[model samples]
Target chain A: MIDTQSSSGSKLVWVFFLLLFFAHQDFWLWSDDSLVLGFLPMGLAYHALFSVACSCLWAFACFRSWPEKLEQWADEAVDPDDNRSAS
Target chain B: MSDFTFLASAGEPVSRTPLYVLLVYMGLLLALGVLSSRFFRGTSKDYFVASQSIGSFMLLMSVFGTTMTGFALVGSSGKAFSQGIGTYGLMASWSGLIHSAVFFAIGIKLWSFGKKYGYVTQIQFFRDRFDSKQLGYLLFPILVLLIIPYLLVGLISVMKVVQPITSGMFPDTFALPDKVLPNGKSIPHPLSGGVPGWLSGLVVSTVVLFYVFFGGVRSAVWANTFQTVVFMITGIVAFYMIADKLGGVASAADVVKNHAPEKLIREGSIGDWHFFSYLLIPLSVGMFPHLFQHWLTAKNAKSFRLTVIAHPICIAIVWVPCILIGIWAAGLYAAGDLRIPPLPGGGPNANAALATMVRTLVENPLLSGLLMSGILAAIMSSLDSQFVCLGTMFTNDVVVAAMGKDKYSDRQLIFLSRAFIVGIVLVSYFMALYLQGSSVFSLGVWCFSGFAALFPLVFAAVYWKRASLGGAVGCILATLFSWCYFFYQDIFLDAGAGHGEYLVQGVMPVTFVFLASSAGMILGSLLTEPPSRETLKKFFPTLS
Candidate 1:
């Protein structure tokens, strides 16, 4: 985990997230007929790569920026009598 | 092959392979349901939410599976055939980003609250959070209304795709006619005695209902996991086999280029406005009732991490193949090597295009049946979840909320939920029959658009401390009115073009409706008294 509590780390994560969002709009490649490998269309191939890149960004965020505080609070505050009706 | 007549009686089969593959797949799902019930804790909560015992991988597969409906596979392929490659860009790519993003943000938060509050349905959560029974009543009808179109498409896709798979299984019952395309190519014909479209649909709905009746979301999760793996693997296998049948991927590309070159370009097919507006459509998943139920089943917050990370990749694996195969179908048809069932104005019935391609190109009936089952798996996976969710909402939100949860025994609750599900299955079955001949891709956009428009209500209820009771109600009303107006104009009033071609100046109505929804949320909340601090503290505990 990359010290997500740090201000710099949070900022860098946001930058990465925004970049991935914008990069999804690949207008320049819309009409490009060039195939990525031997067959995939340029626009289609670019999107495939962009989707993979988003997976990595999410992986990073999940690992580094996991919301530990929310879990701790919920765990602490959950009353034993709070509708525990199992069968 | 395309025209369906109700089979009068069962008959001997020319090829039993396809029907056997379908039976085996359905049996496996039923078996999974039976097996999952052994682990059921025998509580309504356990049935509905799986006792929040589901781990990260199960949660990931189940959520991804529930989200990947026939809309993603059959409908996307259909649109890709009718429209072009932009279909992938418009939905699959954008959904990969937006759906997972919503999971990471909204899903985890809702799961936390649900785990804390003992909530079973989205309506239950909001009913408490907003402290309004009236809001719950209002939401119940609208949510069900949105879900109807979504369910209709699944029924439509299953019925549409089933005819081709069992084409020659019954060669003696009904008279078969050869359909010929305008290009002089003979379309595939259905042999006389195959399973009718009605029986095929009944089998699907019955299997789903049986599994759901047994283990509820636990079965849905298990079946979704099995279904997800089956579809993705078979989807890729079908992809390669079809590409090879077309003489490799490059040869396939050349065919499209020679015939429908515009399909390869987004500017040529789907414009920027429509493409970008689809971002709003995936937001609808944030509010999907089945997905909300799936989120509550997560064992912990950590369960969501896998779902958030892996969802996009899973989407790409399934959609890229389906979209490409559709483009290839257009190519093959134009090259005079293949024929698809025709539309009214002489276009391919795009919704059935994916299955048609699989059956036509991949020659082995066993392989063809397995691939068809894989697509069926993809479609059926969501069918159970959606059906179970409607049951959950009706039971937890309408019945239990109105007649206190304490009034009913756990057995009675389970019985009631199952009864409601059976009724919904029957009603939806009849409604689907009534609404046949509509386009799956077009209807899917409108349905997703409605939920996408109303979804933010739950978001505000979860995240915003100031989102008032009135705001919740206002948001629901505005989204309902706006969605109705847009759907009417697009579907009934203006019969201009297909789904993506025309929608509020190249933009989908979801955009304007979403803006209307947001405006309702903002103005409605500001105009009303703020929420009680007790409610705020309960939901947003870290309110420093």
Candidate 2:
């Protein structure tokens, strides 16, 4: 279980930054002349779709890679039942 | 209604209308300040960080609003006019992802640390985490220096938009001197009889100062939320009206396809290296002191979830229209379909491209005034947060912490903060006046690069246990040195070249600066002692 969890976590981190890397790369240099929907330029349309992909990917990160310890710390700090305050 | 017919149908110059709309917006911000001040609990903590009481929605809105400055609206559009559709790829799309990722990685972590340590300012974090008080001294000035240019970008853009919108309102009172054009025909200045840039900048500065001086961060948050809604709604409306005026979206795209097809494609002139390096600029958000202050205001780590998820969507809402408008302007100018406004010296002005397009395309005075106010909303949303953050930094980091926290009372701290805010506002306002005609996009990129170069320090400080005080200090000095060298080369030596130019071997200056700062940190830490074990445990308590 530990092995699977750690592997998945590392994989998620790699995938996140990899997506960012590809998003930043200007692959549209080749398809510069193409238009999407007969109105939007190919490059502009790619980025527009890329932005939605980013939103989805980040939402996944929030769900998967969110630090468990930090959540516990926040709960402990803000929760009235907890004996220790934040500071 | 044909395009040229609207020029003939131009009604009485509604120069005063934009100003009145802007005044009403300013009045709303002031009222919010006064109202939020009633909830002030008479504590410096409440005044500076709002007692860490900001919830998810307000936190998300304020962060989004603070990031979506006039740069996102006016700067993006202006740059798109010159650069093409790649403008979205250059900043906005990447920023949506990078900024949210930073908020998740850095912002939430900082919020957790701030709450655990009772820290208010970013300097406080560095000073404690690194176990070096001197680090604060080095950081306070550099952060403030970098931020001032960002502040100037906001001020300059406000003046740029307002000047054009309010032109011709005071023709009798303020007639501009006529100058001979390149074609040997004399034409009056476009903004000759309107509110001058200096006056517009001062008015904006004064309005921002009033609220930040009164309610501090709380008021800035409330005002940002209100402004965010105003700009987002009006931005969409402006985009629709402009598209309709240009004979619909399909027709507008057809115009570009026929006249300026190069704009639709990523021009070969923009090298791959320059395009890729534009990605590094968004990393600057990780180190923005204003963003740091906002991060510290989150009620808990969970509050950041909304910001991380919703922020990209908010960025898209604000950016797409601006980018499209700018690209559309290029096509319209090329086809001679629109009467493109000339600059003061009588050439096509890219800086005022968006305002010119809007004013020319939209015939309704009421709609134009609303659109102008929406642009102002975007500008002022950023100015308030920056104003309050500087004041908070000075009071918490410089005055109280340096002088000893016990040396001043809560009331005295608030008083000092307000005084410093007014002083900085005055300095920025004057600087804006002197630096008139600077491109908002270029100025904004320079400022962001400076901050992005310093990202190594914060990233290491938070994540690496071995990151030492010397390392933090070293990174800062390295960043400042490279920042100055590149800024000098780009501004003075290059004769005001655009971002497409390379610093060395087709690489951006940010590439070198980021590397140097990272190298400085790693080398400085290794050469010196590692951070004490106790210090590491404090920041990384979960680790054994």
Candidate 3:
């Protein structure tokens, strides 16, 4: 289980880097004219920045929440009746 | 279409058919298929999922290879061609990545259950999860129905692209009977004439079917590894060659900025909501039977995880060339340097776009033949996977489910699986000849939507403790209801304004159906009592 999580964690890191590449591409959507609002200003750099922020937040959230879920699952495994307070 | 125009349009006339190269490629694929058939002396499990012993690398390759279908290459190129540089932005590029993410997030749990219960089909897993025999039976046909069109679409797209090239080279031998287009022009059928469409379809399908039949998950894995490498390199190379002809990758931006700005930008007329919905279309991919089957075949959690991670990166490489060349083609056409001959049927004219680009860029016949083979490889990779998935599901899930599990031997099941594979190919070939669809990409998207509608019930069955039998059944019914409604409203209803557009906004009816299923799963489970502990133990022994 530890090895699985570690490998999955490293994968998340690789994904983070790849997302960085997509962002660098300034991947345009449609065209500047079509984005009438121009509020978000679409470009690869912007996307890269946003993706980085999102990935980081996701990682943090996963780190914080995964253990609790794991503990709950483990508890259920030990005794399915114990966690009868089913969702 | 006559050979006279084709010869006249060429930059330079060359007699070489690149026959050796073509023979080499065809020989290699056939050899792989025939050689792998020897491994069929095993159980159905070995044939279907390779006894769950697939490695990470093979899994990764198969995932990438199968997903980047011929239509993905040509149809995506057509999209890039017609949409300009920005179509990639509109593309469900992140679908592969997100699907992988979903698998990691929820798939590990499902895999554990699969290991515990020995679940063979996705339908079987759902049956155990919901504890509803009725729901299992209800879903069996729906899953099969939804899967067939997706398979049909892949087969048609491959035939559309590969047939033309094959006919161009071996006109007398491989070309089929001529058909009169809607515009009243006669052109040779790529899959039908000398070899006959049914025969060629059967032959091609047989190659893929035979491999998957005997090789099962193992052969598919190994063959996919070879095919994926070829697909990725060929895609990158094709794009590079096109870009070099234009100038370079750096020059692509300049070319688009100056010549095809409209193509580069999305038009407001299409509506932002409709465009945004394109993003949601990919969600359905995660729910595809074939993809789920691949996930089920994973040897371990690590293989599954690695597959999810590496799959997306390969997607980026596969698409980069297609998108780049598409932009180049748009620029060339816009510059009045190329004339896209009118297609058999008058629509958005995407079919001729990629072919035109290949004609303009390629000079050497041998290189052109290799490049053509690359495209065919892309098509076969996707078609093979689709047929294999369809055949396996039909035999294992529907046929064997009705017949008691103990009644059939492993060899009998394997034989049935191969037979079904061939049967489906013939149906799809006939369907493709008369079927009127926009492009392979569009067909794929429509298929994804159909599958996505049911994903909620499916996902809940794996993860939700309260996903009841009633809920699973309701979910399947709701999805089908929404699917029929969408087909009637979006497709059948004569709202004909845009070019064969069926979806509304980014939200499809399937989404609503999925929501209904989610409600069913929650309410149905709560209203009824849970299954017995013994039943739960039998269903999910490895949960702990």
Candidate 4:
């Protein structure tokens, strides 16, 4: 049911990895004088924003690549009849 | 020394209030362990894997708790204090994304396979996947060896945090012998009146062991959930208080800008290669034996959905506060607003950086006690899981498998597991007492690097159809050899000169070892025969 091999899904995975690659480079925070919002160091602020972006990107990865067949398999393993009987 | 006399010491009268809070927290964990055992089914399956019935909420908390060890709190703050805001870029930012990615890629697949095949331990999976029992023989020792040092890091950190917070509580009882230096000035040791490292280490070990010995993995999951909540709340509270004490966010930023501007930026001292190398370290989570065990406890594959979605967010919530506090500590010190504590040997001790900030800034004794308990919560959460995982490995992989499946009864198997857990705790406790001065961050990095080097094996095993038994063996051997070489160079040959500094041509050693292991796996598989057709079909049913 899941289409991890689909073009869009695979592309998203590649994009996420690329984003991570650039995030660690710390290029924007290279200067000691860089400051954001009048108080935060530019580099610290960059990483803080980057962490938020990572959360969003990972959520997208889950939406695109999560395996559907595994969920179905799990449902089959836990029968509805057994639940009713236990109740 | 009378008890009344012991109660009076220098520097703001030590309070027993914090110690009471910690005792209550420990009591709550013990109660949870006892309660969970009421549902035990008296089978090896229930004892080892909770009969695979953990729901999504419990699963998420346990997995997150196990992964976020003392290093995340004590080590991260300490490192950020020394290295600046670059600490977040080095670890938390990457871990947030990579840890969840691994959960999606490896955790789901392993869970499905485990449910279908009735597999409990990682060794069982490797033994069947390669159709070679010898692979388990090779992997068992390496996995345990890597994990022991990781366990010691957690144990050592608990002692470090507790000793300083509880200092001056029992001055006379723990009094130090005064020594006259060549200058003819007699001075008492700094930690003389505090709870010694050995006693704190023993107390934490015993508390964790008590719960684990009673309830097995199920109790560990429950305990982790409780501790995770405790630490998250305390971590945020400590952050707000410290920021206020430093005279608001704007004032603190001004201090850093004027005095220690380097702590704000990274490019000047932390090279590009060093920054890039940190990305490799988080991959070690994929190959953690304890994590693998937690993954296998999922009631079904759906249990993983919440974990994958929420993991990055949870990481952000905990890490941002600790990283900010450490950075603030550096600024305060630079501006001459705070005094950094001297180590026992009389230098600025970075490991005590976070503790000193909290103790100096947060004045309310009740609040301080709660905060200390929260730090211990983060520490003890990981310790319980790691302790149980080792016990599970020793009993399942080494004992039952070697003695033949039918030789031991279920009760005997549980007994064996509990005994092994006790043995491991005692050994690690002694090691913690002996290796008192080692840096938690450096020890943690080495352990993570060794596991990260072996990540190629687990990645290939799940994805690559052509992966052979020879390749798996080669990957393990290459990782071990690289680990030993770097360790020898850093510890012995260099006389600890490169401790916590990126080595291997200015890059972290994980980068080289990861590349070497991957290449070895590829070449070895190409040189040897591919896995049999039936073996490939079993793992990759859709492709076949």
The full ranking of all candidates by TM-score, starting with the best, is 2, 1, 4, 3
True contacts kept of 2: 0.48
lDDT at B159, model 4? 81
RMSD of every candidate to native, in Å, equals: 4.5, 3.4, 6.4, 5.4
Residues B1-544, candidate 1, lDDT per residue (tens digit)?
Answer: 1111122222334566887988998998888889999998899989899998999898988988888888888888888877777888788888888888888778888888787777889887787778778788888998998998888888878888887657667675644666566789864453345566677788999999999999988999999999999998999999998888778888888888877677777776777877778889899998889899999999988888889999999999998988888887777666666556556666667777887787667778898889889988988888899998998999888888788868999999999999999999999888877776788888888889998998779778876788998898789899999988988887788644644454787788899999999989989999999987666656666521
User: Which of 3 and 4 is the better model by DockQ?
Assistant: 4
Ranking by DockQ: 1, 2, 4, 3
lDDT of 2 by residue, B400-484 (tens): 7678878999999999999999899989988999887887888898899999999989899888888998889889999999989
For A10-82, candidate 1 gives per-residue lDDT tens digits of: 5666788888778877888887877778788888888888789889888887877777766655556565434
Tens-digit per-residue lDDT, A11-70, candidate 2: 786587686778667674544766677777888877887788778877887777766566
- Runs in model 2 lying further than 4 Å from the true structure: A1-10, A26-31, A74-87, B1-15, B341-346, B495-502
Candidate 1 backbone collisions, by pair:
B1-B190, B170-B193, B170-B194
Q: After superposing candidate 1, which stretches have Cα over 4 Å from the reference? A: A1-8, A79-87, B1-14, B177-194, B498-500
In angstroms, the error of model 1 at B121 is: 0.9
Query: Tens-digit lDDT track for model 4 on B369-438?
Result: 8898899889888999999999998888888778877899999999999999999999999998887787
Q: What local lDDT does model 2 show for residue B164? A: 69
- The clash numbers for all candidates, in the given order, read 3, 0, 12, 0
